[model samples]
Target: MGADLIVEVALRHDRSEWSRIVPELCGGDAELEALVRALLAHYDRPDSPLPEGPYPVTLGPFTLDRELGAGAHGKVYLARRASLDGFVALKLLRPGPGMSEFVEQVRREAGRARRIPSAHVVPVFDAGRIEGGPFYVEMAVCADPDEESPGSIRIGRSLREAQPGLDPGEAARLVEDLARAVHAAHRTGIVHGDVKPENVLLTPETHRVMLADFGIATSLAVSVAPESAPIGTVAYMAPEQWRDRRAPSPSSDVYTLGGTLYFLLSGVAPHAGREVGADAPPRPLPASVPPRLREIVQRALAPRPEDRPASAAALADELRRFRALEPTWHDRRSVSRRVLLFARRHARELAAVAVVLALLLPLFVAGYRFFAGRVGELAAGEARLHGRIQTLDRSRADLERDVARLEGAAESKQKELARTESRLQQLPRLEQALGAAKEEAARSEAALAQRDAEAREAALRVAALEAQVAAVREALADAQSRERAAREDGATREAVARQDAGRALGERDEARRRLSDAEARLRTLERELRERDAALAVARAAEREALRRAAALAPAPGTK
Candidate 1:
């Protein structure tokens, strides 16, 4: 019988009842009976301590609900706090002879976590030893009611479960929060020796991330001797962390954070090596990840501690800037690269500006020409007015001369009349001459009035022309201003386009390099595959030859 079926049957009966029924179930087969008995013995063992099976109903102030997860150190359970209304994670330490150190470690973790007081760090509630049983610690549950528990899901699961992957910005933000928590611990002289995705907790409802499990954390102030083997997950540990056999520092945390980010982005650790080389290139990130972010991750994962960010806080700052699309320290270091990235990011805006400038170009030229034409017309009108003013002045001068001559003639006539008064015969002739001179003076006055009217008309025309000229000049200035602005905008667009082109070229070259590397790897794999195929073919032939020889050596069917 199958072990599962035997166990199922065995559970349904009491020990004495099962012992009598097992032989009948096995049907006198010794092997089957022995197998059933072995399975029964495992099920009936008094000290199995199965995490998913029977357990005490309560531990101190908490009532156990169900098992969340189990590890070598302990089994965590979803439990209701007797004193509180909310659910908490109750981790019950395994019972062992040398478990005092583990219990002390749990207490230390609780104390360290409580002291930090950061939202990103999971809070610890209480720790105590259950009477005649395992040691347990109650901590805040890091999960939502409808979502998978934090212990059930890890970074790899989060990535794999989602189609494609998490959004790059969201992943970066999550890691940034994690780094901030680590930084907070570092500031308090606490190093989270174990920094990996499995130890990071995520709240599904709030999407808030918290760093969990500081069991291996060490304080810099305390002079604890280094262990023979390095602590922390091997995949994320720094090279110096292992080679130097030293306690983890802020830099070690930084490396693991980078590895976490790498896993978030690419769904794999940066490298598999327990102690990666300083010069080893990090696994390439996906094309979706921004180059700046990828570079930041790579730098943080640098094998040498000194080569990485000085602290987790600095790494968090870089990630924050990346998420905000602001210039980072790396971008600030290279002006051309920064400009190129800016141009590429804002290409659409640049294109819109260029279109606007193009559309305004003809309007600007036409407006300029229209204003220039109006100005020329005003200038011509002004010149005509000046000429008319000169002509009016000449006419007025002529009229003044005639008026003076007429006055002179009238005075001469008056003198002649005075002399003629003595002689009665000359009296009629002087009266006629006076009438003629009077008519001549009236004509001269009319001519002067006409000239003055013409001059006044010319002055009015000049004033209107001056006003039109001023208006045209203002319009011309405005058009010139707009044209200059358009030109400047066009120049800027051109510069941006050139920069974008350069960036595109660089990206194409990068793509080609990657393709070449991929091709080289493909060739190597193909070679290995062909070698395996040949070996497989040779082995099959050798087997056939052996079979032929064996058949030939077999005795003739009837002769033996």
Candidate 2:
């Protein structure tokens, strides 16, 4: 049975009822039963002793130092390779029952991420399986460059965790940088199945974007599981992805990139805490967002995949163009000022053009008079020139329309700047509140650490008690066995003693009977001797007697 079933059973039932629960889930597999028990043991008490093997132990060439994070399938550890100089992130698939496929998944994650050679993508260094252990991938650790300390390691934080509420322009630039990285992945024939704020990492000082977590990366040509549940974050998922209708493509990544931008601008995801609707329109951006940026985001978050940007590269290009025009949008100069500046900057060129026109004026008059007689022949040429002038007029009108739109945008930008300044005015108060929150968080962390230490100690005590109880149980079992054997031995000895006593009694009775008969015979012989003496006495009295009887008895004795 799968370990998931065992875990589910353990969680669903009361802890006291696991005795009845896990055995059934294990299906009589002793190893599975023990494994689930160990898993639950560790789950309940992290400090509890593990089975025969655990991490912080060596796997192949890397010695796992500590667990950095864990997910359903595996754990990431900060590890040091024996032959390597720096630390690497080692992602190892957790070994358990029914996890054979997960091993291949980890291998594929490493393979796909390793193939995309982009600075924005976390580089995979190596991947292998430990003999009789687990599969692991070694990759470069993304750490905060700002927090770097000599002879110490720094862990990187994801963009959402580290920095939120970015300015609209910064958000656009960040997403643009990441889009280029996504484009690079697509070029390498890999589609990052999951792209959200969490997957994007930013180096603190430089704000460098590092797109990570290719664990769910799929082929650019087709999705590996198109009919499955949406493979990406729901808030940023494209409509087609939500429907699971087709393979995730570069356009899907662009859609998520737009969602990321939306989040940065509004401090909330585009569709946070909601399911994707079949006919949902793109959410309107905040008023503070520039029209150009909003347009870009809305286009990327199009309901139909085809309606969105064709590729991540195209999305990046749009953002690039927006950034290029951003300065002009922020410029507060009126149209008149721009015209005057243009004129001032080109005065020399304008003077040269005027001098050329002056030199050509007389020639033009002479030519017009000379050609007056041929005016009928030049009618077709004049009509062509008139058509060209009309086209130029239309072009000038279009330019005027563009200028008016830009003027409106510039006014909106000024209002946005005012709002920004007003927010900046409250910075000190916000900083104070932030300081208070950090202090409270520090206190909470300290309290939590104490509680954690106490919990660990309690776990140790409980484990000790359990060990003692087990020892007592074993001793009780041994004593009971000894007691049973002793009772059996005593009963056998009693039975033999009874048999011997009965035989001795019978022999004694026989001896007593024989003695009684011999005594009876002796008594009878005595009586006969006495009677013969009495008769001899009576015969002796008739004559001279008693003496005679005695003499007769003596003579008889002599004759005999």
For this target, which candidate reaches the highest lDDT against the unseen true structure?
Answer: 1
In order, the Cα lDDT scores of the candidates are 0.64, 0.63
TM-score on alpha carbons, each prediction? 0.53, 0.46
* Pairs with backbone N, CA or C atoms under 3 Å apart (clashes), candidate 1: none
Kindly list the per-residue Cα lDDT of model 2 for residues 373-447, writing each as its tens digit.
588668978999999999999998987776565455444534543543463355356446435644644454344
Candidate 2 residue runs with Cα over 4 Å from true position: 1-75, 92-98, 126-136, 144-148, 215-227, 275-282, 326-560
Q: Please, what are the lDDT tens digits per residue for candidate 1 over residues 226-317? A: 34766666677777866776667778889989988888888766656534544254668899888889889989988778889888989999
User: What TM-score does candidate 1 reach?
Assistant: 0.53
What is the Cα-based lDDT of residue 168 in candidate 1?
86
Clashing pairs in 2: 540-545
Error of 1 at 195 (Å): 1.1
